[model samples]
Target: AGGISEALITTAAGLSVAIPSLMFYRFFRRRVDELVLNMEEESLKLVEVIHGEREPDRTSEAA
Candidate 1:
């Protein structure tokens, strides 16, 4: 009886820690994905500029 009670207590404790840790891990993973996408976009723009594939807008330059 005592062994079963101890097992149950440990199981509950482990889940309490695991659930929140998993949630935080997922949240940060999504944030990292967004950051990576933004970096890729900026890098592509830089590459375009370097190759002269994209022209700078005259209106933006005037501003």
Candidate 2:
């Protein structure tokens, strides 16, 4: 067993599994956050454009 105990092997295996899992989760979370932010910005731009178009109509109605 190369003088390795069960506890040592388990610990090493756990570290190997947990490190990659944590990295993958963080990477995906960041990507998702960026995607959501981009979507929100696009939505806001669309709303602003729509509001701008309606502004002239409202001004004409008021006049």
Candidate 3:
């Protein structure tokens, strides 16, 4: 009987720790994902501008 009670206490403690940890992990993961997505969008816009500037050089070369 004592062993069972001890086991139940340990299980409860584990769950208490695990639940908060999972919540924190998910919250941080969502934040990082948003940052990464924003960076990617900005990078794509920069690439498009650089590519647009190169068009004039290509036209001059053809002439």
Tens digit per residue, CA lDDT, model 3, 1-63: 999999999999999999999999999999999999999976776687688842333433555
The residue-level lDDT of candidate 1 at 41 comes to: 88
Give the clash count for each candidate. 0, 0, 0
Q: Pick the candidate with the highest TM-score.
A: 1
lDDT of each: 0.90, 0.82, 0.84
Query: What are the per-residue Cα lDDT tens digits for candidate 1 across 1-63?
Result: 999999999999999999999999999999999999999987897788789998654563554
- Per-residue lDDT of 14 in model 1: 100
> Could you arrange the candidates by lDDT from highest to lowest?
1, 3, 2
lDDT (Cα, tens digit) per residue for candidate 2, span 16-35: 99999999999999999999
CA error at residue 51 for candidate 3, angstroms? 1.0
Ten residues in a row with the worst lDDT in model 3?
53-62
